[model samples]
Target: MKQRLNLNLVISMSCYSSLYKPSLFHTTTNADIKAYLVGKLQTCKDLTSATLTHSKAIISGLSYDTFTTNHLINCYLRLLRIDHAHKLFDQMSQRNVVSWTSLMAGYVSHGQPIVALRLFHQMQASLVLPNEFTFATLINACSILANIDIGRRFHALIEIMGFGCNLVVCSSLIDMYGKCNLVDEARLIFDSMCIRNVVSWTSMITTYAQNAIGHYALQLFREFNHLRLDKPNHFMLCSVISACASLGKLGSGKITHGVVIRRGHDANDVIATTLVDMYAKCGCVHYSTKVFRRIQNPSVIPYTSMIVGAAKYGLGTLSLQLFEEMVDRRIKPNDVTFVGALHACSHSGLVDKGLEILDSMNVKYGVMPDAKHYTCIADMLGRVGRIEEAYQLAKSVQVERDGYALLWGTLLSASRLHGRVDIAVEASKRLIESNQQVAGAYVTLSNTYALAGDWENAHNLRSEMKRTGIQKEPGSSWIEIKESTYLFHAGDISNCNQRSEMLSLLRELEERMKEKGYVGGTTGVVFLDVEEEAKVEIMSLHSEKLALAFGLINTPKGVTIRIMKNLRMCRDCHETFKLISDIVERDFIVRDVNRFHHFNNGLCTCGDFW
Candidate 1:
């Protein structure tokens, strides 16, 4: 009898642990152990009825108990067999908070937030009280739905249930509020927290960054450090780096880069992407490219960020080259990648290239063209003086949301550039009728009327704009000299340091350029130019000239002056700046109206395409 008992024990143990494992008579009695095995068996296709029956030994022992029943339900959930899980949950004589919470978690995990909420309601009706986990699961549903109302109600419910102070629950609340455009409220909750983790810090910083409050985000980052709390993690670093990008603070971005390297978090892909984006946006494309090259496992986010950064910094060729490399690596381009590519083409006036890509947005890439893509194409055409083609392309889009603003604005700008008054006037009228308070459309109409020699209409439009209190944005330009920047605007004499010198130099430059046969293009004249008034209006109060005068007076001899004009550089100014560059024996980079004009030895890189 003893020998017989020993034989049976040996058989069971061999089945449980053998290499060529037999699948029966498993001897575990812990429900945790059995549930774990059942979850594993559900994943293995070859595990048969014999093994499952062995699992049932412990499952059946705990079948009537809510704790074990919840465990069984969770096992089915791991298999996504929610139906079977629900069946077991229903058959139990009792239901507990854990059972409902487990089911809710399963639904949330599977992206069925609505189903999760429905089950929550059912649980509530069943008289099962919710705990911290229950509210956290429901808040997850609200975040997915972007339902602020549901989120608020959940907040109230958590308070009523005394779970509001739960750090996990409050963390999710901050995240939900931020996603729903309630950053202020999110901050209120975040500040009210008794304990905060890295997640809490990262979420708050990200909220401020998303809402265009970069300074506050950075301030928070400093405060986070001052706390001497847990060291900054990858998420916290990325959040603050993104804030630097939005603010265009290259110094802060560089500091963050140093932090990333020092902390050894540079290996994280998310941190890598944010750093690339920050440097790119801060106008340090070289650093951006360098960081991008070092990425060991570059993903779509980093690739897209680098592409966009290159495009925005006027490195259209580099952007396209990297895009080709991305394709060569089999990395798929998303909508953002195409948008950046199209913008590069537009900015560089690569018309044929832009057209090819716009076609491929739907053909090769399967991304339907959004309004932004169409706007980039239209902007490219208009910048290259293809007013009629731009107008036609604008018409062919079949749907126009804000494209009307873009299309008409582009056409009107092209008209102003090439002296196409008729087209400008027609487009401007439609634009004004559609968007009554748009200051740009009003300015375009006034400029068009002036170009058409209709002084009455030009003055009337200006007067109308004034009566409606629609003020045009003041034209300004920034120039970096001696590592600091100075801004200039029309009629601005407020830089007391250079007032007299700037005006005198501007007059001298104008006179010398005039002697070189450069005349102000009276084509911008409205109400018939009587020569003097046209020249005065064209020459003085021009934003580009004001910026140039400031640069000329402030800089040393032979120093290159770079000015960016908020409005298009008039044809006359383009010609005048070329002669000024020659006379001053200095290069001048003027980014105006539409494109870049680099003038040296009396030539523009654009060759007058703009």
Candidate 2:
């Protein structure tokens, strides 16, 4: 009886075990767990909480593989949990190239390029070879840091590792070189490439344009047009158009605009903004306004560009209107936008409006005024003979080194204009103390002394400059005609072919001006001992006048003559251009280093204020 009972018990146990076997064996594998965690990390909206929870769960439940750990690090980075990511990275039992690259990228994305570079060096020390992505990320870091030597080291490594042909790597190299101001090296790399893409072309084009080699930029764009590969994108169009604008090549600019329209990129925000800027800088405010109006929902950049364009051409009222409209549209103005508004106020002699805007910058818009904004306000005040207010305003700002220098420089210029010898001396002192290398301050002070009839002091300052080897920059001007640019320096008689005709045209214009009751102003020349007649003669051969003459003689009748000068327009030149505009029955547009001067009908857009 006992043996029979035991057999039945054993038989019952066996039956129960077999019945529940499939359910008991249904457990998740490591791979399945990793996939589930990855999905949660990727799709989670609240990445901070979800990522933290999932990462902890991952740590507790399973031994994470390299792939799983990399994903977790990436998730932490996305959540901006750099500390947690670094901890996990350090705790990893075995790290691969992906592991190192993941953390390096995290550092870069967080704006810690230096930390990223350190991680790269650490990875190199650990003997883990970086992949293409690693190399690309490190190259970007180098670009941001502007560490050209470090970038070259990596380039050498890439070449030795046979990864130079990788398109992404090559593109990054081009960008790195470009940012380092090594455009020629960038071009060499570009030319040597077996394959090219849109990004590579854009990088080279932008480099040339930004480095003041706009002509080269245009030539590159022409070459890029012949390539049957990718079509020019909005970025490329913006860069090339900016190049045209800088060179004052309106013809080339129009051609680029046609390309933009043909490619259906005219509506792109960057393209539209750049087009507005291009037209404005090239002295075609009408075209600029047209382009700006075409945009459906313009942003701050476009609005600011339009405002600045209006101000550049002396349309201050329009600029103010645009500013008000932009505010009404609920768009927040940035620092640059305010600068444009301030510049408009200054040019229009709107002292109250400019002051209101300056006050509102911090109170209403939360945009703190920087050195440039302060400089504009000071300049405006100084222009209207409010020297005390301008001085106080500049002195009130606790600006950086460069900003302080700029403020003082503006004050110095204003003093020179208004014949405030005491203020000019103080400003000159401050400027020299702050930036001893600036030649403008010394020259301005000398000129101020000469204006005050203190010729001895002026001569002493001139002697000091000469003793110190502080040579002032010679003024130069350029005018573009039919795709060719003619350059002239102060007292330049280099172009013998056009010298006689230019001088003759200038003399005729002078005669016409004299008949219209325009007397030559001797204030512009700084040669204290020279006779008044010689001063007038020397002033007549100023670079801007020569360029204006060249433009008038070469261009068609009734066309506006545009000249670009490397320095501020002198008082005499300003008066001469106004008279010439009326006598020639044409507009004279001069873009000096400071601002634009539009002379028409015996009046200047600056309202005789600039």
Candidate 3:
């Protein structure tokens, strides 16, 4: 109260009489002096400069000037001195909307979004209405919070306040809805906009990309290009690259790389990190390495992406090598970084190394193991035929239901592979009764029963799944040839333009494979009471095989074929790829739900463990 009352007299030179003095000033020079102080406060790039200018402002009696005070608050915020900024804010005698909004933004930026929300309530109580920037900052706070209920309330408030069409607020709403996984709601906001800029497009595209709807993201990007609204900015390009990685569109990914180079965004570390992940997900880890190597100063993100990428293709040594190098560089590894290291250890049969990394995660790096890291550890144990140990670890992880199901699912997958039906049953049973109802565990357990000739159990599990409305995710495989993606599903070529030729090529490959002692793995087939011949035929037409056939027919011999599958590659397909690779003298890379398998010369990079 005292500070607020004193602010009025601050401009009166009589009040500043330290011991006895009041000084006279020229009106033009005094105004010029105040304006110059405000400008210096506005432009202070660091705390030292900002504090120095602030001292000068106080000596010049500009500290209590509302305009100058607002600039100082913003400067302190830019320097991340949120405490100082808020102190100044509370001391302000008169605060306009800019004053409130700037402080709220600082809170949001500093990750104190609840504090920002409280500030909003106080601002409203003060009869200060929010502007577009204020709404934008609040909406961003909701995004970080990921509270859709509160976010929806903000959306309603924006509409109530007639800010529905404001570009900045609308863009923030799109981002908020996207983070909440309400894609259609976000798209509705985007479509209703009268005009859209690069920020709007990037927000919408990022929403689609991050939500696993990459096809829609690609469609949006194509539309953006058709309209030629603006050159795709860094964030927009990064999202598109991520979409390409998900779809395994190497050719389109290459074109995106060209754009990156053309726009000189190739050197940006953030974009480089995204590109590293993109290439790694697209079944091109070597290309990921090339992009990662170009970054002179490596951060945790790029190194983690590189490590996880190498692990995906069973390049465990390289992944661990990168991990050691990262630690030696004094770059602290985050939880995700440790996940990558453990994942590398699991996939490459480095069980001992993986255990070491897991033990050191908390002790050495101070990274507490999360569900993902624990999942990797379970996978490592399961892969080495330690099914009981893996099962016990999964049961002991102390995670939520979803994470519990995930760990058990991994154990079930390993059990099915290792002929441990007892472990699979317990894991599946626990998963079914758990709060998180998932389809993978049920399907894997059913498949295990079928493989072991326990058809009754398989039928019962499927019936239970159907009764509960649990649907197995339909499996699909994609292969890109000449910039166009071709998709296939099990025993289905309904979408293929060259179905006849592809089928003939598949038949020929089977004949050649059979000639080389390759037996159709009908025992691994999940069909109930099916004839052997029928099961063999079904196995021959699996999605990945169809994709591989298409790739072989289209690409030249020895051109490494890449296939992306939405589910884990079955044991039969894994075996078939190994034989077909040697018989046809071509290499194949298949990225399935779990990991990458590189097949060459009658061997898979996974060494048949996967």
Ranked candidates, highest lDDT first:
3, 2, 1
Regions of candidate 3 where Cα sits further than 4 Å from its true position: 1-28, 467-469, 490-525, 528-610
Q: Write the per-residue lDDT of candidate 3 for residues 1-610, one digit (tens) a residue.
A: 2122232243232124322321443257768887887788777777666776666666666555677788888988999888778877777767999999999999998889999999999999998888889999999999998878988898899999899999989999999988888889999999999988999999999888777677788899999999987899888999899877766666677888899999989989988988888787666778899999999989898899899778765577888999999999999999888877887777667888888988998999998887777787887787677878887787777876556666766777778866789998887778777844357677677768766777677777777776787776544556555445566543244456866555555567657655756565432323321112122111222332223223211222212122233212222343454554554455434333222111111111111211
Ranking by TM-score: 3, 2, 1
On TM-score, the stronger of 1 and 2 is: 2
Q: Residue-wise lDDT of candidate 2 within 410-437, one digit each (tens)?
A: 8887787667899989989998888752
Residue-wise C-alpha lDDT for candidate 1, range 1-610, written one tens digit per residue: 2121232232243233333322343346454665665565445443233235334533344344455456556766776767666655665557889999988888888889899999988988999899999999899889878899989999999999899889899988988887777889999999899999888888888777766666688999999999988888888888899887766666777798889999999888888888888876655678888889989868777888888777766678888988888889988898778877876786566889989998987888788986667666776777677877877876677646455565556666666655677777776777778873267667666656665666677778777876788876544444323234445643233463554554455667657755665565332222212111232143222232323233211223222222233212222333444554565455333222211111111111111211
Q: Quick one: best TM-score, which candidate? A: 3
Q: Assess the local accuracy of residue 323 in candidate 3 as a C-alpha lDDT between 0 and 100.
A: 95
Please give the CA lDDT of all the candidate structures.
Answer: 0.65, 0.69, 0.70
Model 3's TM-score against the true structure: 0.82
Error of 3 at 207 (Å): 2.0
What lDDT does model 1 reach?
0.65
lDDT of 2 at 135: 93
Clashing pairs in 2: none
User: What are the TM-scores, per candidate, against the unseen true structure?
Assistant: 0.69, 0.76, 0.82
